[model samples]
Target: MTDTAPASSPAESPRVIALVDDDRNILTTVSIALRSEGFVTRVYSDGETALKALLDNPPDLAVCDIKMPRMDGLQLLQKLRETSALPVIFLTSKDEEPDEALGLAMGADDYIAKPFSQRLLIARIRAILRRSALVRGAPEVENDEQPAEAIRRGRLEMDPLRHQVLWNGQPVSLTVTEFLILEALAARPGVIKSRNQLMDAAYSDDVFVDDRTIDSHIKRLRRKFRSVDPHFGAIETLYGAGYSYSDG
Candidate 1:
């Protein structure tokens, strides 16, 4: 007699997320929360092991603890940046605001303070993963048979199809959130976007992030572009009103 089994659907294939922390409790608790949300998790006790494993088999996203034994999160991230562009989110303690800012400045996609809400974390993870999928064209359905072409405003060029950003003809690396915010503003040049509107663009409806989060991302974006082009001042800040892209 032959047995038949139903094939696993695309939705059943859980997205992999790596969790690296020195605390066993955090690892276990976060793993439970992630698994409950239909995400496969890889837990590592230290940055050293996590870095090694991540290089061997990369995950869709990673949540790393800032303070760890031997190899710290910053060190791990710096080393990883040398070879990989994998998205990273740092887990910081309540008193580590400075560290969180530094991490963001150092190219981390995002950060979560200690005593974080599991629901919030899940929402953020989903938001990041969704953006990644959009960039990779991995969405289950084709909503648009004719996708929009790349948008070019001055030296800043955004390619939705290729998920590439060129600043003065040089490649500029941007986080998913940063890219979305820039795209939103640049799509309509000279139009100011409020903090709330920019937040809506960077995150999903389920993710309720602070306005200041958008500010941080904007700062990072500026620093990144300035690194590529010292005179890069395309992103204009309207203080209180929000941000906009300069056409000239």
Candidate 2:
């Protein structure tokens, strides 16, 4: 009998990740760690260079430093928000609550403290990429019937498959974290979801985030929705309980 050996599957191309940090040590260390996990990294010393590189050639995700010389991470994120929905994870060195809150409010997917473990970073990266891939239809859902492409509740419409959101027929731009949080809340309207529950849904693999992080995302979500509908009051907060979505 002729011997038949099964051909091995080709190796998949590594995902590109942009790393923006003023510290050379971080760039080197993080890049090496990421490379070992089969991720291609493009490191930048400042936000300006990173912004230019991202606008010209976008990456699968970006890890940015909160403080940098000329064009800080917050400023760069603001600029990027004006055009693209690039997923960004802020790297904050200081243990300041405001800085972390601001970053999350400004649409960062996640944040990590400076003295963080490489394993945690890798886990967050994988979690985000998996969610994004699901939206992009990679290794699609295995079911006899296709899942609904869009979920609509009153004026708000969310298309999980397309990774798109619309309020009153107008498109609303949201970061990966924001979208995930909103999706979780909207999935079951009028149900109060505690901070812990929200965190479990949006940031299951995220290590450094806390309850305040979910609150920040909720505040930002309200601002975004209200901007579109001046009288928007969909997301309701129960003081002692948690948060719930109200179509009315």
Candidate 3:
């Protein structure tokens, strides 16, 4: 059976924020809070409905709870990553919540424990949207130094203009964020891009994305690249530093 996120229309608004949770109270509070901030909000009660709506027509951003019946937020996020760069944040219980380091490994952009404030939630949501928007719109930088290229690696070829990625003479499906990360690392070629550097580069000149966001994207990139070729392991983790793309 196919799974999907529910869709709702708050207004004919340009910006939309989606909230998915089994708890009616949390959904109501978040929806109201987001609306007060001048954003159109869509609320879904379960992962299946949320996934459906998202597939039919995706929202600008989504806030989902970590635990749920049926599909769960983790599965939804993985599914979403297959095609969209929609920004996402997770709501988690204080004691059960995974640490920033652990959560990033599972591909969450941001995680807020149960006792989170409305203000912090709102601010984090806004930050992700702003950064995601900026990063998603950076095809025409017109760099004078590198003669401007689409997605050219030593052996990999990607044409962001066409939204295409290939590794070792084959097509590879990567989320928009994943493709961008790989492109940035390759652009450096032997240069280490620290977590901060990766964040800045991925968000396109300092728009501001969470450090965990970069980590999540990098994890996905490694999976996709390694699937193509084990030695295609161009990305090197400098432990505390960041990442480097070396043909080495």
Reference-based lDDT, each prediction: 0.80, 0.81, 0.70
lDDT of 3 by residue, 37-107 (tens): 77777888888889888878787788888788888888887777676656678788876545444545555
Alpha-carbon error at 4 in model 2, in Å? 37
Per-residue CA lDDT of model 1 for 80-160, tens digit only, reads 866666888899998988888777767677788888988878878887887766655565425762224688998888887
What TM-score, to 2 decimals, does candidate 3 have? 0.75
List of clashing residue pairs for candidate 2: none
Instruction: Estimate, for each residue in 1-248, the C-alpha lDDT of model 2 and write its tens digit.
Output: 01111133227656788889899898888888887777888889998888888999898999999889999999999899878888888888766558888988888888888788999888989888766665555554345323346779998899877788999899888877788788878889999999888887776545546777888889888888888888889899999788999877
TM-score of 2: 0.89
TM-score of each candidate structure, all chains considered together: 0.85, 0.89, 0.75
By lDDT: ranked, best first: 2, 1, 3
**Over the full model, what C-alpha lDDT does candidate 2 score relative to the true structure?**
0.81
lDDT pick, better of 2 and 3: 2
lDDT of 3 at 96: 59
Off by over 4 Å in 3: 1-13, 82-84, 99-103, 138-149, 158-164, 169-180, 202-216
